[model samples]
Target: MGPEAPRHAYFVPGRIEVLGKHTDYAGGRTMVAVAERGFCLAASPRQDRRIRVCDAACGDTVEFNLDPELVPRAGHWSNYPMTVARRVARNFPGIERGADIALASDLPPAAGMSSSSAMMVATWLALAEVNALEDRPEFRENIMDLTDLAGYLGTVENGQTFGSLVGDRGVGTFGGSEDHTAILNARPGHVSQYSYCPVRFERLLPVPSGYTFAIGSSGVAAEKTGSAMEKYNRASRLLSKITELWREATGCDDRYLAAALASGPEAVGRLTQIVQHARPGEMDPKALLTRLEHFLTENEQILPAAGDALARGDLARFGELVDRSQLASEQLLGNQVPETVYLALSARSAGAVAASAFGAGFGGSVWALIEAAAADAFLDKWIQAYREQFPEQARAAVFFTTAAGPAAFRVT
Candidate 1:
């Protein structure tokens, strides 16, 4: 057993993307808010070099010898903590400690709520505490700030971080770090507007008075391992090809869709004209134009316009933008699944002021901005309708109100 040590608990919130879903991987911007629900862990150091992990929710426990060479095992939830620990050991020299960790969560995995990212964040925090990384001068010398650490952990999962457990460098999906940012840096009652090309936080937009956010799960899991991985990779490839095409025609090397947008509406207008006449033979005949339309519209119109509406407390206008973004997700981005589309539409019809399918889409959940006073009634009606439509799925679906919460914290 490891040496006896003091115990501490940690919590890391999950994140919901309000707009600009797949755009993050292509260097576009996104709006993300931390959810109240997330993963929680209680950990203590042990004298032995063995590590034990317990998942109270799943009634599963795993034990392993602490080693820098630990690798992820398929279908095993223990891989999350093991991978984080291995990364810390591999990256930080002179760290030869292990801990017993107990994990639990109300966050639904694969619900587009970033449950996996939350787990990664919590695991890192626990390891830091047990290793005394904060107090050790050597470990603290080049220590990462919360935001940087978040992005680092994200890269670790995507198989981009140096010394990641998975040999391929990613679990499968090629995604960006918006989830990490929201999980580690979001403030309560506000949403973060960030640019991914350079990964910087631009601004914080507060929730207007009298309004709150609610998430309704479609009950279809957003698995990134199977065919979903192919679809996600395809979207990213299309975005890259579009950027290359734009550079070839306009002589702009900015690569980011946001850059083209920054050149003003006239630039976007002219680019669209060029694309129309540019010989569809070289482009992804069906997706290129639609993807460009969605990307340009999001950067040039929806995001900024929605930011203004929310800042000015114009919930009605903000709601309109939400609906429009959902349309783009379905028609242009092609990420929406039938259940998610139905949930967003049903929320609106059930009196939600504005509703959109949030997160990566193709499954997961939809978030609705609605009057606080009417939240309960809206949730009840929406869930009931969803159950009637998807009876078998109703057992797995989740619906509830949530407020923005702190990204993460140590309880003791």
Candidate 2:
């Protein structure tokens, strides 16, 4: 690749998990919107099997061979693109060419805005563009649509096999398709609801007129790596353990916690009993029960009602439901930090209709819904409150307002 070479440009936006916290992977539903901020990439094909990526913002470059056996450079940002390259190489064979990609992003990294997932989606798009992977038989057979592609990409991140695509070491997070779904399938000016474990679109509700989301990054890096990875995965693992118990007790092979609970009206009570009576193993029974409680309330009660509130223009009711979701994240999921908690509470105090910390929330950002006219003042007051409370975090904290944005696409 040279300066004179023609390049394909693409943009992948970050996302806001507006209502569903830690519910996607459990085969549950979530409402999400795309952020105005995201990653932009210019990629050109290479004649050889070497993929080179340069981060324009950070001035970091990583080059690796496009091989299925490629091992990710642990803790390095390159692990994201490298994982995509490895998975693409394995899933679609006879890909002799690679790419020279230069990327830049306005989205904050590790701030729970799906920056990492956006990077992966961008890399996958670049590779797919240069190689025409979508034309491949395997790709066509497995990924029939964007929804299917999102599900497959989720597996790519979590090291799970999708259809006939074999599994490999992922970026080391046991997560789901929510981020990918929103990135690939989001509609502008609307928050979309989706269910995972074979991603399906439920419906889309237009964001109320004159309302926009103000995001306050808590200045806490919520990178799904290191100790934070364990905390994030713990929530996911609890769902898995509960599903395991459900299968054992009922003699059913439902793959996800959501599926088991949806089995019957009495499924919830039965699962709760199962969790309460489980023999101790990898997870404490008490922790399992809390996870169950959160999932039930969030997936069954709060998400649908919130969506309905927004549908009917019931902003007050919507705010109250969002508040319940936030409390569940704090009390039941145990993923909220002092910074995030304060951000949510203070945003409400600052006149946001509703506010909550989102993403894999051991430490991350919060989203506050407010009038478009008041966003600036709300942001000012919210950030001032946050900074006054935690001065050390003020330097890293970022605040912005955005409406729902479009999904990932080629920038022709």
| Deviating ranges (above 4 Å) for candidate 1 | 1-4, 65-68, 134-144, 161-168, 244-285
Q: List, residue by residue over 1-412, the lDDT tens digit for candidate 2.
A: 5879879999999989998999999999999999999999999999999999999988899999999989988898999999999999998978998999999999877899999999999999999999999999998889999999999999999999999998889999999999999999999999999999989999999999999989999889998889999889989999999999999999999999999988898998899999999999879999899999999999999999999999999999999999999999889989999999999999999999999999999788999889999878888888888888999987999999998999998995
The best candidate in terms of lDDT: 2
Displacement of the residue 360 alpha carbon in candidate 1, Å: 1.6
Local distance difference test, each candidate: 0.78, 0.93
Candidate 2 residue-wise lDDT at 204 = 96
Candidate 2: the clashing residue pairs are: none
Give me the overall lDDT of model 2.
0.93
**Candidate 1 TM-score, true structure as reference:** 0.87
Model 1 global lDDT (CA atoms, 0 to 1) = 0.78
Which candidate ranks first by TM-score, i.e. highest? 2
RMSD of 1: 3.5
Candidate 2: which stretches are off by over 4 Å? none
